[model samples]
Target: MSEQVIAAIDGSEFSEGVCDYAAWASLALNAPLCFVHVLDNHSAAPSEQDLSGNLHFGAREHLMEELSALDEQRAKVNREQGKLMLEAAQKRTKAKDISDSTTRQLNGTLVETLVALEKDIRLLVVGKRGETAHQASGHLGANLERVVREMHRPILMVPATFKRPEKVLIAFDGSKTARKGVEMLARSPLFAGSECHVLIVGAETAENHSQLDWALDNLREAGHQAEGAIRAGDVDEALQAYVQEHGIDLLVMGAYGHSRIRHLLVGSTTTAMLRGSHIPVLILR
Candidate 1:
């Protein structure tokens, strides 16, 4: 069976860009693609409710009219608009020869929809902005970081503006997470024949150097040609400079290192990298 890439999309332009990236990866890996749209129930609930259900007949009739008016005014886009957007998204996928695609409109929370579909999905692509974008108040969408922690699948968090990555940088620290990342590169056709740069930061001792060497051997053994180098500095700064200098297309790294709490408070180097890197990030946990 072909691998499956699940891209969560809304009708925005950013969602369309995410679909394009998902199509590229799906085609490269020979996988099927699915476009998903989740409607937040909180965003769709009726603005006003009638007390008519419990009121006297005369007052009930008056309140019923008010409720009906409120509901009519609250109606944003009808079901027909949703269908058209979904059809257009599916057509975009078909144009790229990814004809075997499905579009879904989900009700309830995005996290719930994602958690339910996590098992069969190989990659999850999401647009950074949503209808809630302007209201985000400088946060990275509420359920996003949570999904990254909970979902076992790899997540490609696409920025508002994106370009296909030509070369990728893998942040290797010789951890189990890093090893899994190497495995992803080997099995994924997206990184096949592309320049894979193995960056090892914070190697201060002999044991650290030995560990770095072992990690390099693993990548080479996996048939992904890679070059390794050790830099002396904070992980975030070193990675940023490396990407800027080399014109790196993507940055692959483990999600959390020591602990989630510590990472959240002080912020892990990986988290810091995400804030400043500006490139698409593939985060594995």
Candidate 2:
């Protein structure tokens, strides 16, 4: 299969924004769009009922039949709902002049499905908060961390509102992952017209300055008007402040600088930045 930009839709309020960003990315990268909706079978399964009150053999048989019928009905309804969500997403993509678009309703976890389709995906677009995450107060999407940790491709987490990015901020820490992010931005047309700003959060050291200067030169050589800055403070706080003060439309950063276990235990800077930023975040692995 050819590479495509995949959008994860869950029929939530943020689905439209996800579709918008996915369409923008598809057009920018000159790639086809694929919208996927997963019918989490585990979450959708009907609960078992207590039948101790009337446990006759015929009653038990009848109850089992009823429960089976209910399960079937629920599965049918879920399939229909997922189909509707995919159709709506497809229509939105087409409205954005993205005619080469397709939709799929998978019957498993989002991460598993994406992993299976990893080879065919150039980018993955998802909402900052999913349907369940929005219902839970002050909680990031449960799948956000896992998906970023598991997927090897770049993932774009779209916010509730869609904004055309004019200025893009890249959070650089001079790691190999961060360097790869810079190189990806330099080569990809996704941010072609956006002003690029490379922000390094640390004290002014010769090595730091050299890295920033090198990154700036790389972006400039790629036909982008780019600049670099050094900030001294907590990584997340300084990055968020810079984004807000400079009116950054999109935030780009490396994913999983530390091990997955460490990130799960103490939280990674990437996750913290995503939780703090109001703008869309592009996480590169």
Candidate 3:
């Protein structure tokens, strides 16, 4: 089977957007699209239960049986709900002209399920927030952050709404990690036709200028219509400003890189760009 662009949907408000973006990637890469909905099995542990054995023998057995039945019932409902979500995701992809897309309904933690299928994944698409997440929380759903950190394949983390991208931004910081992002874009057809911008948020030092020139040259050589600039400000502030002023539809970056740009993914202001920006993020490993 061909490597698949997998979109992890969970019937959340962001599910539709995930489908749309995944469809775009599937078409661009000429890969199969698979919609996956994993049943999150994060239930209360046995340790958290009332296991004091304070009741009579028959009462203890009855309580254990009741709990088991309840758990079974909940899993049953989740299975049916996941099936419907997969079907809806398939419909959405079909409407995008991806008639041959597939879906999988799995019972396990999302992270482990995706990791097991890692060998077959060309790209993974997921929503920033999950069904249980609240918009007012102002934080990324825990699963999203963990997946980005652990998954080996490139990931496309989408927002609650999506628009076909017209412009793309690379949050380059002259780090090896950031350079890897440039290489990923140059090799993939996903951003082949979109206008690309390489923005370095810092002083326009001679070294910074050299780094920008190197990026532009590499992208140009790879047949991408790319340009570069060095702006002065904090990494978070400058990036946010440039995105708004330039109408960037997608933001690309390398995770675990160096400096403030690096901090944007793993530092105190981890969500500075991923959560702050209104566009989808393409995180290259």
C-alpha lDDT values of all predictions: 0.71, 0.83, 0.82
- Could you arrange the candidates by TM-score from highest to lowest? 2, 3, 1
Q: For model 2, how does the per-residue alpha-carbon lDDT over 1-285 read when each residue is reduced to its tens digit?
A: 889999999967779889999999999999989999988866756667687575876887788898888888888888899899988888877788987689888888878888888999999999987877777535567677778778888889888788999899988888776787898888888999778999988889999999999899989999999987999987777878899888999988775467332252136533466765688988777
RMSD of each: 4.1, 2.5, 2.3
> What TM-score would every model get versus the actual structure?
0.81, 0.91, 0.91
Residue-level lDDT of model 1, residues 1-285, one tens digit each, is 344798887755567778788888888877788887776646665655546576766996777678677656544353455667778878988888888788777766788889898876888887655546635434565567667667877888777665778778887776766666777775678887777777777747786677667766766776766776778777778888899888888888775467332263234222556655567877776
Please, what's the RMSD in Å of model 2?
2.5
Global fold similarity of model 3 (TM-score): 0.91
User: What lDDT tens digits, residue by residue, belong to model 3 across residues 13-113?
Assistant: 88989999999999999999999989875543244467646786688778788878877888888889999999988887888899998889887888889
The total of clashing pairs for model 3 equals 0
Error of 1 at 274 (Å): 2.3
Runs in model 2 lying further than 4 Å from the true structure: 256-270
Candidate 3: where is the Cα deviation over 4 Å?
A: 44-47, 51-57, 135-137
